[model samples]
Target: MRKLETRTIVVASHNAGKITEIADLIAPFGFAAKSAAELAFDEPDETGTTFEENAAIKALASAKASGLPALSDDSGLMIDALNGAPGVYTANWAERDDGTRDFAMAMEKVQKALQEQGAEKPQERTARFVSVLCLAWPDGHTEFFRGEVEGTIAWPPRGTAGFGYDPIFQPEGHKRTFGEMTAHEKHGWKPGETQALSHRARAFKQFVETCLEG
Candidate 1:
């Protein structure tokens, strides 16, 4: 892996939630993280079909634009019952006609789809959140890390702490949904510590171990 030599990097995303989460994750390593939105960088279209491909696209775009290293993440929810219908299109599923996103609608749609497919039992509602992080340098060199958290879909969408489809996602061994958990609880992974609870946390841990470790 090509180690990230610089301490300052752009987080290639316009989403506020993603920026905050990523910034918090990298802050412990003494990295000066900046979001693409904060830097006035345009969000490149994610034309790739896979998480790795999309992550590379964003990372490379921001790195090239800023002439610095950039980190990008592509994540999604994949349901066993839906046969991963929304894998790469996870965000698209929540996109609104007004150019906004409605995750509550997305959750309801997922629940409805599950019911249509006869996925009633807890076992039948198995799912996972997948994330792939890419680190790219200005010269276009890049590395990728992937993570996933297994879980089951909860009906009636509980909690409101998290954004997106967190209200409907219950990670394995947990009684409460991700939406009910605080940021510290959801992203509780650390280097050489306990296992990660969220997909993004798992992927971020890998990035820290590979690039930020002294």
Candidate 2:
């Protein structure tokens, strides 16, 4: 693993929600982070079929452009009933013709699809959130960490605290959706903890252990 000495790394994403969450994650560790949007980095085409591929595409692009280490996350909600219809295309589902993303519309699409598929029961609505984090350096060195959280799709999406598909995802053992939880509750772990609740957090924990200075 490459030791990341630079603290001010690019987040490699234009998503505001992702940037905020990532910034929060790295804040306690005292590392400075800037998003690709802030740095005016061009968002690259994610032609890869898998999450790792997409994440690496973004991370590497920023690393090369900025000559600094970059971290990128490609995440999505996958419903078993839908055969993971929106896995890598999760964000694509939220894309509007005007180029703005409407996650509310995306959530409705998920619910509609589930209803059409006759996925009424919680078990039938079983799903998982997948997150893949890629850390890339200017020299082309890269590391990948993947994480997942099991959950069921909820109808009439609840809460507004989270972005994307959080309102419709009811994680296992939790009555409320991720949108209902605060950042602390959604992250699911503290600094020294071994486990995390969310897929991004789980993957981030792995990245921190391997790349960041302790």
lDDT of each: 0.91, 0.92
RMSD of each predicted structure: 1.1, 1.1
- Which residue segments of model 2 deviate by more than 4 Å? none
Q: What would the TM-scores of all predictions be?
A: 0.97, 0.97
User: For candidate 2, lDDT tens digit of each residue in 42-122?
Assistant: 889999989999999999999999998999999988889999879999999999999999999999988899899998999
Candidate 1 worst ten-residue window by lDDT? 188-197
lDDT string, candidate 1, 32-76, tens digits: 888899999988899999999999999999999999999999999
Model 1 regions more than 4 Å off: none
TM-score of 1: 0.97
Candidate 1 positional error at 76, Å: 0.2
Candidate 2, run of 10 with poorest lDDT: 205-214
